[model samples]
Target: MTDGQITLTGIRAHANHGVLASERELGQTFSVDVSLDVDMDTVCDDLTHAVNYALVAQRVLDVLMGEPVNLIETLAGRIADAVLAISPRISSVQVTVHKPHAPVGVALDDVAVTCRKDAE
Candidate 1:
């Protein structure tokens, strides 16, 4: 494994993911951050030898908008799985799901869930 990582941060999307009925009715903005451990030792002079971050972002967005989940934990897991499926060269992946407009009735900055997975 090479000591290199590709990070995609601040990916904003609108999704209905929460326990409250209002949350599912009126979707809110969500932010996603992903980091993939990749092998930088590979010989490359083109994008083919590296992970396409645009495709990675789209994969995350696809899962975010695909279905409604009640918890950010589940969403985080799905994102990790999706990224891990992208390529075998990816040794590990970390995914974070941010919920800024939580209905906790408390004044808070944001709530988020992070998940990490390693290739088997």
Candidate 2:
């Protein structure tokens, strides 16, 4: 099998997830980025030999819009897990969850957590 990487960036969703009650009650926007390492054998010619990224993105969105979690770190981990579960060809995945309006009491552009998972 040959190794290759696929990346998806700037995925955005709205959810209520945080330590503070207000964060959960009011909800906010979240951004996600995903990168996957895969093994393929198509010489870059066949969709049948490659991962279907549209499906992958939908899975990530499902996680984003599904359950509520307390931390972006956990969200990142879940996304990594979800992507890795999609196909055996996916050898590893990295997910980044971004919180643009984190309730830190300080001004910031964004707060994010990144997680990675590998097949065992």
Candidate 3:
């Protein structure tokens, strides 16, 4: 494995994901950050040897918009799993799901869940 990483940050999506009924009904915006640890040795002039970030971003969006979950942790895990499935060159993935509009009833900047997965 090479010391190469692909990071995608600030991926925004609108989804209904919360424990509160009002939250589910109204929905909110979510931000996702993903990092993929991959081998960069094979990457040269061929695009096929490289991980397409566009595809990775799309994968995250697909999961974010696919279903509603009460916990961001679950959503993050799904994203990590999806990213790991992208390429065998990817050794591991880190996913962070941020809920900026969390109904905490207190002043807060954001609430987020981070998850990491290793290829088996």
Candidate 4:
């Protein structure tokens, strides 16, 4: 990460997304963390040059709250794409999504997936 690189992290409320009937009816909350790597040299003169964590968080919330997804993986992908679309300065992105209330039979703490991408 560079000197002024930034990361955005938060938990979002999402609808249930599983083949199971019960999961479909009830929604749950999922946690998401996004790391954005950017070249801040151009924006060094102004704070705006740096990635705004608040904007990132709001964007993530918009995706999660606006759309109904079948899987957290898809949500993560959409988020990563959204971030890159919004900030061309972002050179790379790492997104991690956590589902704490997965419908697993056995006792488990949480389920999560991480995706790393380089800007095109």
lDDT at 42, model 1: 58
| Superposed model 4: Cα runs more than 4 Å off | 1-4, 42-45
**Per-residue accuracy of model 2 over 28-116 as CA lDDT, tens digit each:** 99989999998977576888778999989999999998888998888888888889999999999999899989989899999989888
Give the alpha carbon lDDT tens digit for every residue of 1-120 in model 4.
254467777656676655567767787777888898887765356656667768888887778776666777887888888888777778888888888888878889899988887789
Candidate 1 lDDT, tens digit per residue, 35-113? Answer: 9998865566677777888999999999998798999999999989998999877889999999999988899999999
Models ranked on lDDT: 3, 1, 2, 4
TM-score to true structure, per model: 0.94, 0.94, 0.95, 0.84
Model 4 global lDDT (CA atoms, 0 to 1): 0.77
lDDT score, residue 78, model 3? Answer: 92
Report RMSD for candidate 2: 1.2
Span of ten consecutive residues with least summed lDDT in model 3: 38-47
lDDT for each of the candidates? 0.90, 0.90, 0.91, 0.77
> Which residues of candidate 1, in runs, are more than 4 Å off?
none
Query: Deviation in angstroms for 90 in model 4?
Result: 0.5
Give the clash count for model 2: 0
Best by TM-score: 3
The per-prediction tally of clashing pairs is 0, 0, 0, 0
